[model samples]
Target: MPWAHAGYADADALAWFAHCEQVRADGSGHEFGIFDAASGTLVGGCGLNQFNTVNGFYNLGYWVRESWQRRGAASAAVQALSRFAFDELRLGRVEIVVAEDNAPSLAVAERAGALRECLARNRLKLNGRFANAFVLSLVPGAPNTIGGPLSPNTALT
Candidate 1:
């Protein structure tokens, strides 16, 4: 994933975790690791970040490990995260921006029931270069049924 860090060092992981904590602490966003329910293995990560506070929306992002790709992992994560955003965070909108060439993420967004909003020009930075992106969005009370609604006390466990 272009959005992922290039290194795999322990220090890098620690820094990433610390950053996640800071994000949560500052009320900017929250990030979570995606784990396989049956095996309890880390498969990917997802988050709600880049708050547009005035607009009552957040940017939803996710990535799945290569082995877990094509098996509904990304879609499931998107559904759960969006539900959490809506129900728990009380946010009014969630946006998924996928690079124009990133077919996998675009598919995940569509399958998760996010409506495509636009093809934003130069909307993404990938490997130090800019790229156009497709913007998709999810709103409250939409027809999305995957994973159902998250309960009041429930989180992405």
Candidate 2:
């Protein structure tokens, strides 16, 4: 996650993999390797994690590699994940915390119709100093579920 997001850690990585295993074992957490449907090459990645089954809340996060930023890859992946979250997982809410400066990422979240809720100032401790972050979400409504295979997709926007 550090390579894709930021920061690095020892136990965090281990714990994360372990979490992935646990979630996958029960058929919950998902890690999707993004690919170019045209070229069949692994272009990047996307998935939903930190899932909370009982409360029906989880996190949505992903990276599309530096090379595959535009092209609507992130939007496609997020739409798929969000559909899974709402349709399959039956989740009511999904949240995404994005670094404020990451316009590409923010754009991805926005394109997915996630609302910007707040400016979390000095909220994330990245390198000893707190970094500002944007709290965005897919809370059952917005516009632009415009590009994916989401069932009743038109009803959303």
Candidate 3:
């Protein structure tokens, strides 16, 4: 539904839902949601979008509630998700394009060991304006993790 608010409205979340199902059927995209363990709230989502199973590549993006910033929640979830992609899913790579000005998110990406590839100009449209972006990725052995749920107390800020 968030994708609807972001622009794919007429088809509703059904479009994205179908997309997820198709990818899961064929070995590409997979959607995931982040939750707060203690509070039991849907904090945000993270997923593989615009994916290619043969190439083992997908766009990784995540959003945590504004209230949850700096808690290491994003990094932890990404760590688990990345591991799942590489190990269980046998992915060769997972790429993420993040807004350059989002320092905290960039830090989280770095902490998760995603390598910065480039600074993309006006890559994402937000509030009707295109913003500069940073491209990063985690390939096999990059972060070299094994999938699991977020362990907040063990996370880094």
Leading candidate by TM-score: 1
| Candidate 3 lDDT tens digits, 97-152 | 88879887888888878888899999888768899999988888644433455675
Instruction: Report the Cα lDDT for residue 8, model 1.
Output: 69
lDDT of each: 0.82, 0.72, 0.74
Candidate 1 matches the true fold with a TM-score of 0.89
* Winning model by lDDT: 1
For each candidate, give its TM-score against the true structure: 0.89, 0.74, 0.74
lDDT of residue 4 for candidate 3: 27
Task: Give me the runs in candidate 2 sitting further than 4 Å from their true place.
Answer: 4-19, 26-28, 127-129, 141-147, 150-157
Ranking by lDDT: 1, 3, 2
lDDT of 2 by residue, 115-139 (tens): 8889899756775667899988886
Q: By TM-score, highest first, what's the ranking?
A: 1, 3, 2
Please give, for residues 61-156, the per-residue lDDT of candidate 1 as tens digits.
998788877877777788888878887998878999999998989998998899998999999988899999999999888775345653232225
Candidate with better lDDT, 1 vs 3: 1
Clashes of each: 0, 0, 0
